[model samples]
Target: MIVLALCLVDEARCWAAGESVRSVVDENALEGTPAALWDVDGAGDPTIQGFATDISINRGETVRFKVTTDASAFRVEIYRVGYYRGAGARKVADIGEAETFAVRQPECLKQAETGLVDCGNWQVSASWDVPARSRSGVYVARIIRSDTSGASHIMFVVRDDDGGSGILLQTSDTTWQAYNDYGGNSLYEGEPAGRAYKVSYNRPLIVRGSEYRRTSFWANEYPMIRWLEANGYDVSYLSGVDTARRGHLIRRHKLFVSSGHDEYWSGDQRDNVEAARDAGVNLAFFSGNSVFWKTRWEPSIDASGREYRTLVCYKETHAGEKIDPSPLATGTWRDPRFSPPNDSARPENALKGTIYVANCCRFDAVTVSADQAKARFWRNTGLDTLSRSQSVLVGLRTVGFEWDSDLDNGSRPAGLVRLSSTRLDVEAALRDFGSNYGSDTVTHNVTLFRHKSGSLVFAAGTTLWGWALDATHDDPDKQSAPTDLRLQQATVNLLADMSLFPASPNGALVVTQAPPDTVPPVASIRSPRTLEDHMFHLPVSVSGSATDQGGVPAGIEVSVDGGANWHPANGVSDWSYTFTPDRRSFVSILARAVDDSGNLQPVPTSVTIKVSGFARLIYAGLVGLVLGCGALLLAFVARRRRLLAKRRMMGL
Candidate 1:
C-alpha cells in the first residue's frame, strides 16, 4: 500500500464551499496509465506529431490542433496532468472514431530570411470545446496513429480566469517555443545566419522524449503540479501569453508563480508581473534563466491576424540589432544599448531578486549555510538538529542546467536574503554553453525578500527545484536526484507563511490578502539646495532621494530640459545624475521616481539653473588653446631630444 505523506485532506471536504482546487483533484479520480505508456518513445521523424493552435484556452472556449502525419488516420486522447494517487494524469476526453479528427494538414510554410517555420497554413485536424466544469491545469493531447503504432503528444493549459485561487502558475511556453526546432530552425540554430531570429508558435514542438519533454513540461513543471495537487494547494494555471494579454487576472490571485526555464518575456508580460507584485501579490519564481531574453509577439501570416503566434528574439548580445526587424530591442533584458533606445533600462534582477549568471548542464545540490538553516522557512525540516558533520544535505539536486546568483549589480531588491548557497564547478559544465561571468566557480542562491507592499517574493534560483517535489516527474537522465521530504516540508512551511493554508484538516483552504498599494512615491531633490544657480562652463550634478509606502522605489529618472527627454538615474531611493548642457542656457532639471508597485511620481522636483553662454565659450577657447599649445611644446621638446640623442650616438 502506498501512503500519502503530505496534506491529503479528507475526501469529504474536497468539495467544500468556496474551494475549487480540492474538488478538481478528488472528484472522479480517473485511473491513469503508467508513465511509460503516456509518454512518446523511440522517435525519428515521428509518423504522428501535432501541435495546439494556441498555448492555452479559457473555459467554454474551443482549442484547435494542427497535425502532420504519414499515417492513414489518427485519434486524440486528452488528459489533464495532475496527481491521482500515484498516477500523474487523469483522462478528461477521448476523440476517436471521427472522420474529421483524422490527420489532414498542408505543407508547413517557411520564411527564407528568418528561417521561420509556420504551420499556421495547416488545416485544423481536431478541436475541443473545453467544458465549463473542466479543471484549470496543464492538459496534454496524445495523438496516436490508428494504422500504425506511432504516437506523440501536444500540450496546452486550461485557464480558470474566474477562479480566485491563492496561486496562479504561469507555464514557460515561450521558452518551449525558443528551443523548438521543428521545420528547419529554432531561435538557437538554423541556415541563413546560424540561428533564427524569430520562431513561430504555430509549428509542432519536435516529439523528442529527451529534448522537448525534458526542457519543459515533464522535467520541470509537471512534478510541481503533482506535488501541489497531492498536497492540496489552491492553485490555477495559465500560459505566458495569458499573462501578457489577460494580466489583470493576476490581481485576483494572492500569489503568482513562474515555473521552470522561463527565459523569454515580452515587455507587457514583465510590466503586468511587476504590477501584480506592487499590488501585494506574492511572487514565487521556481525557475532559472527566467526573463533573460527580451522578446515581442507578432501576428502570423494567416488571414486571421492571430496575434502572439510568433516569438521574436534577435539575441543582440551576439548578433546585434541589425538583424532585428522589430522597433523594440529583441536582445538580453540586462543590456540597454539598443539603437532605438530602450526606455526601461532595468535588468531582470530588478524584480527577480536574483539574476541569471551561468549556463546549463550542472546538477549541483543546494546547501543551506549553518547560519541560514535556522530561518523560519526551515522549520520542521530537521535542520535545527543539523550537526557540523551532517553538512551536505545530499539528494536535492535543485540547482542545475542554468541557474541564478545574487550578484550586487545595483538592481538587486532591498532586504534580500540568501536562504541557501551552493558553489558549483562550472568550468567543464559551461564549456559548451557559455556563462555570463565565465568563472571557474559560480554560486547559486535561493533568495527571499519582502516588498514594500507587504508581499513576499521567493525565488528558487534554479531550473530543477521542482524535480525535488514529486517522484512521478520526468527524470533529468544521468543527473536525476531523488525527491526528499525535507524540501516538501519546506514548501508547505512557505505556503503557510504566505497566509495561505488549509483552515483545518477537513476545512477549505484559506488565503488572507493585504490591500493593494495605491499611493505614489514622493521624490525630492537632495543636492543643489539653491534652486537658482549660475554655474557656467561646469557640469551640473543632480541628486535626490525618494520615499515610497511600498518599500524601495523602483527607480528614479532625471530630465534636464523641462522633461522633453528623461534618462534613468544611477540608483534608486538615493539617486544621482550628472549632465553638461550642450549650449549654455537656462535649463530646468527635473527629477521623478516610480515605486516598486508601478506607482509613478505625478509631480517632479524641478530646479532651474543658468549656464552663462559667454563664460562657457570663453572657457572652451582658453581650454582648447592651452591644450593645443601644450601639445605643440611637448612635440617640439621630444623632437629636439631625439635629434640630440642621435648626434651623441654617432659622433661622441
Candidate 2:
C-alpha cells in the first residue's frame, strides 16, 4: 500500500499552512512503445483550417481566426447554431475571396495514438470580433478552398458573460484535442508530429466529425448539445477552457454538466468544482473519467507577446515545466508518485468518489449495483422494488472505451451510493496492477453521493454514456453505440434529478473570500530527506508541507518521481506517504506549500533519490514471478469454465 502523507501545523498555529500542488509521478506511467512512424499526411484537400483565437470567447470580446491553406484564396463564413426558430445555423460573418496565408506543419516532440498530425504553427485567416448583441452558443467557421473546391469548418463556443441561466454545458474540447487528427497528429496519434508531452492549441482542427459538424461533436459532445438545445433546456455553451480559465462563472448556473469523453483536467478545474460543490452548485459528470488527469494551462501568446490566443498542456511529462506555477504531470489523476507526498496525492477518487478501473471499449450489458437495484435513482427506469442486478437493464451494449470503479483501498464519499456497474473481463497481462485486475470478471462502479452542502456528485462510469441516448453518430452505414429506451429514460431521470434540488451551503457561520497572497509559501521534505544505495523493494517514507503564513494551508502535495506530477496529500490529522520503488535509477523528489490566501511555494524543496541497481533487478524478478503465477491461474480458470460449459451442454 502506498501511503503518501502531508504534515501541516494545526490550522491555529500557522494561520493555516499554504496550498501545495506537486508535479505528479505515479500511475499510468504511459508505457506502450510510441508509434514508430511519422504520420504527417500532407494529403487530403487543400484545406483552409484554423482555430478560434479562443474557444470560450465571451460576447463582445474580439475573436480571431487563423487559417492555413495550400490554396491561395478561400472564403471564410461564420455561423451560429442554436434555436434560431428552427432555421439551424444563421450566417453571422462572411469574408469572401480572401487570400489564404502560409500553411506550415511543424512537427511535434512526441507520438500520438491515432494516425493524425499536428500543425503547431499556421497563418491567420481573419479576426471575427463579436458584437455586443451576440448570443451564446456554438459558432463555426466555414472555409471554402477555391483551388481544390474543398471545404472545412472550425468550432468555437461563444460564452455569455454569466453563462446564461439554467444548465451549463462544459464541452469536452480537451477530448477533441486528444483525438484531433488534423495535420496528422493529436494526443492519440503517431510521432514526429504528435505533441504528447505538450500539446498547443494554436493550430486548426480539421477532423471534428465532418464539415457539417464538429469532429467529436457527433460522437461525444454535440449529440447531447443538440438534445438539450432542441428540447429547450435553457442551456448555455462553454468549452472546457471556460472551466479552466473562469471557473467562478460556474456560480451563474444551477447545474454544471461535464459533457462527453472529458478525460483531461487541470488542478484549477478540480478546485473550482470542489469549491462550487461546497457553495451548493449541483454537478453532473455526464462522462467517465470526468476529473481524471491533473492538467495545467499555458498561455499561447503571439510573437509580439501582446496577445494570448492559444492553450497548452504537457501531459504526464514535459521538459519546460520549470517555469510553470502549478506544473502537474499531465496524466492519470491517481497515485502518490505523481503528486507530492506532503499532499497525500489527491486521487480522482477524492472528488468523483470513484477510480478508473481499466481501458475498455466493447459491448457489455448494463445493470444496477446489487445494493442499488431498487434505489430511488432508478425509480424512473421501471426497475423499482422488483429488480435484480443480475438482469440486464439496457438490453444492449453500454460499456465502452473506459470505465470507473470504487477503489477498495480508498474511502468513498460519506454517503455514496453505488448505482450501476458491469463485470468486466480484463486481460491477465496486468497482474502487476493487482489480483483482481486484468481479469474477465471485474466490476466497474457508477455512483451518486451528496455533499454536506446539499449538493450531489453523480458519475456515469462509462465513456459512452451518451451512446445510451442517441447512436446516430452522423453516419448512415457506420453504427453507433446502441441507444436504448431504458437508457434514455434513465438519462432523463438523471437530468431531472440533477436540477430537482438547489445547492445549499454547509452553513459555515462565517464565510469570506480568501485574501490575495502575492507572496509564495516555503516547503521542504518531512521524511527521508536524504538516501543512498536504497533497494527498490524497501519501503520509504515521504512527506512535506507549505507555510501558511497567516492563513491555513489550502492544500499540500508531493512528487516522488522527479517532477512528473504533484499529487494532493489526503489526511485529516497528519500527512505522509509510504512508497516502494519498483524500478532502478535516480529519481527526483519535491514538495510545495499553498497558503489559504492562495499563495504557493515559488520554488519547492528537492531530494535526489539514489536506488541501487541490484534492488531494482530483484523487484523486477518478483513482478515477473507474480505475472507468471497469474497467467497460470488464468489458464486454470479458463479450463474450469470450459468444463462447466461442456457439462451444461450435456444437460448435466
Candidate 3:
C-alpha cells in the first residue's frame, strides 16, 4: 500500500508543476538555414499572422521592414490617411499588392512543431513619389499575423535638420461620423447625400460605406508627406496618440500638429496636448474645428466579429450640459461652438483665411486700410486681411473676417482670422504686425482656459501649411501660391521677435553683475527688536533715498540695529525704516539696497535705540498727588477749629 501511494503522489506532483512552453516565433534562426518554420503555440491550433510596417522615403530613396509569423494564409494591407479641411478620416488606395517587386524571401525559412519555431524573415522595400507639396510629419504602417491574432506597428517622421524645419502631426485612434453615432456603420437620419450635396449644407456632413471607412493607413497618398518628401525633407511617421499616451508623445516633438478636422478629443488627451503647449510646445492647426467636441472611446467587438473602436460625442447629453454647455447644438455635433464664443461679424472669424474660402469659392476680398510704409494691399492672403482690418480699427479685431469698421466698432482682434484679402504686400503687413501682437493675438481670446505652464501657441487661421506650402511654390498643382516671398521673410522677421521664437543673444551673460545705484534697495530687520513695554513697530525701509543715474529711485532695504540683520521691505514706497520696539531688553535696526542684478550696496544704513522703564515713574507721580491733597485737607480743618475756639472765648 505504501509503495502504491508513493507512485500516485509522484504522478500528482508532476501534473501540478506544469510544462514550460514557448509561444512566440523567432525570425533570425531561419537566416541562411534550411528549416521548415511553422506553428505558433497558443490556446488552440497554430495560425499564421501577417503585418505591414510603414516607412517614409525620399522620391528615390528605398526603405525596408521585416515580418515573420508561423501561421498560414499570411497577407498585408496598406492604405493612406487622406486630408481635407472638414472631412474626418477617409481611406485611400490599397498598397498591399502594389509593391510586388519590393518583397523578398526571409533570410531563412523553417518549420517546427516542437518547443519553439523560427519563422524565416521577410523584407519590404519601396521608394516614395514625392509630391511637390507634402508637409513633413509622421506616417504609419501596421503588421498583423494573417492566420493569428496579433499586430505590430511602425512610424516615420519627416525632418529637415539643415534648415531646422520639421512638421508635427497629431493623429487620434477613432473618428466619428456624427455625434453619438457609436456604430459609425449607420448614416445619420438626414445625412449621406454625397460629397457635392454635402458641401451645400455649409457645415461638416456625414458619409458612409467602406469608401468612407475610418481605419489605420500607412501607404496612401498623404499630401503633406508627399510634399515634404518631394522637397527633400526627412520625415518621421508616428502612430495615432490616444488619451493614454498623448502626454508622452507630445513632449518628444517641438511642434504639435493636428490635421483633417480633428473634431473629437478625449478629455485627458485634450488636457495633455494643452499642457504640452503651455510648456513652450508650438502648435499648428492644419485641420478645422478642432477640439470642438469631447469624445469617449468604446472598445468592443461588433456583430461581424471584428474589433470596433468607436468614438462618441455626447456633449449635449452630458450631465452638466447647461452649466458646462458645449458650443455645438443638442443633436448636431457638427457646429464648432468653441468656448468664449466666436464672433460672427463679417471679416472676422477666428478660423478665417483665404484657404477655405478660396478653395470653396464662396467669399470675396474686401478693401482694408492702406498704409504705404506698412506695406498695405487688399489682394493679400488671409494674413494680409487680418493686418489691414486691424490697422485702421480702433477696437477689438475679429479673426477670419473682412475688416468692417462699422461692425467691430473698436475692439481687440479675435483668436481666429478669415481674411478676405490676399496681397503679398498685405501679407507682409500682417507679418509685421504679428511680431508685436503674436501673444496677444492667440492667447488673449482664450486667457481664461490657459495651461499652467507658459506654452507658445499660434493659430494659423489659414490652412496654407505655412513653410510646407513653400515647397510647392513652383508646382502646377499647388492650391494657393507660396505665401509671398517678401511676406514669408516678414514672417521670419516676426517669428524672430515673438516670445515664442526669441532670437538668441550674442553673449551668454551680457549683464553678469548689477549696476551701481541703478535702483532703490529694499531692506527689513531679520532679528526681533525688543522694547521696554511691547509698544514698538518693526523698522523696515529702502536704503538711501538713492537715485538711479537715469533719475529713477533706486530701490532699498532696511534692518534694525546697524546692519545686524535684513528683510525685504517690499511694500514701503519711501526710504525710511521705523518699527515699534518689542517688550524685550535690547534691539538693533539695519537697512541696505540691492539692484536688479543682485548687487548689494557698499554699506548698510542702520539705527539703534535704548528704551528705559516708564511704568514705575507713572505710579510714583500718582502717589505724590494723593499725599498733597490729604495734607491740604488737614490744614483747612485746623484753621476752622481755631476760628471756632476764638469766637467762643470772645463771646464769654
Summarize candidate 2's per-residue lDDT along 510-593 as a digit string, tens digits: 112223335655666766657655676778677765454544443445667665556545431135666777778786777766
Say which candidate scores most in lDDT.
1
- 600 Cα displacement, candidate 1 (Å): 22
**TM-score: model 1 vs. ground truth:** 0.73
Of the two candidates 2 and 3, the one with more favorable TM-score, higher being better, is 2
For model 3, what is the C-alpha lDDT against the true structure?
0.31
How many backbone overlaps does candidate 3 show? 104
lDDT of each: 0.74, 0.56, 0.31
| Residue lDDT tens for model 3, 1-652 | 3432332234223223542210111101111111112111111121222222222333222334443345333333322222211121111112342442323334332112111111113443332333222223343333344445454333333322222233345542233233212112222222222110000101111221123322112111133433333322222334333333435556655656554434445545666765666676655554433444444333322222211233334333232232223442321122233322441221222221111111111111222332211221111223333442253321111122111111121221221122122221122122110111111112111110012233323333322233232332112122333223332332232222222231221121121111222333344433334332232343322233443232222234454444544433432224454455544444555555543222345556444545434454456668888898988999999999999999999995
Query: Over all chains combined, what TM-score does candidate 2 have?
Result: 0.61
Which ranges in model 3 have alpha carbons more than 4 Å from their true place? 1-167, 172-221, 226-240, 302-308, 315-454, 462-652
Off by over 4 Å in 1: 1-22, 27-30, 42-45, 99-104, 210-213, 339-342, 386-395, 428-437, 502-652
**Tell me, what's the RMSD of every candidate?**
11.0, 20.7, 24.8
